[model samples]
Target: MPSKLTTVLAVGGVAVITSNPGSGMHALVQEHQMGILIEAENQQALNDGIAAAMSQDTTQFSQNARRYAEQHLSLEGVMRGYEQLLLTC
Candidate 1:
């Protein structure tokens, strides 16, 4: 998991991340509609991403992020996963 991305999402904050190859950041942002993904090492892209993030209405993004966190990253979810693992073991 992308720890920094998860942290931002868990707190309902929008992330502006670089689209690094093999990083999965793009996929996560696209799948969840949670943040802006910019081309890595591109200053223009970074500027544009920040501008877009600031200009856009982020209510949906915030909601999606919080929902993802609760469903996938919460303590309850982790405990359930552990329980399932132990049951199988």
Candidate 2:
């Protein structure tokens, strides 16, 4: 199942602000230029990330996020992945 954040990205055009604690979420956000990522458990970093996300024009980020979601997280995309997996099996 897709995470809530992934679902949001798949359905909405919005920027994400999230913490990175060595999870792959940071990589995804960075690779897609989707939003602001901050060090986990750091109040100051979180605050700064939020500030940056709010201050910048996030249109490109939103577009990138949506594009990534469409390519990787959409229902059709997931089905294609599953089909390929079944074929391999």
Local distance difference test scores for all models: 0.84, 0.75
Give TM-scores for every candidate, taking all chains together and pairing residue i with residue i.
0.78, 0.78
Worst 10 residues of 2 by lDDT: 12-21
Q: Report the Cα lDDT for residue 8, model 2.
A: 66
Predicted candidate 1 versus true structure: per-residue lDDT over 63-83, tens digit per residue: 888888887789997888889
List candidate 1 stretches off by more than 4 Å. 82-89
For candidate 2, write residues 1-89 as lDDT tens digits.
23777866876556545657567777777877876777877888878877887788878878887888888788898899999999999
Report residue 5 deviation for candidate 2 (angstroms). 0.9
- Candidate 2, residue 69: the lDDT equals 86
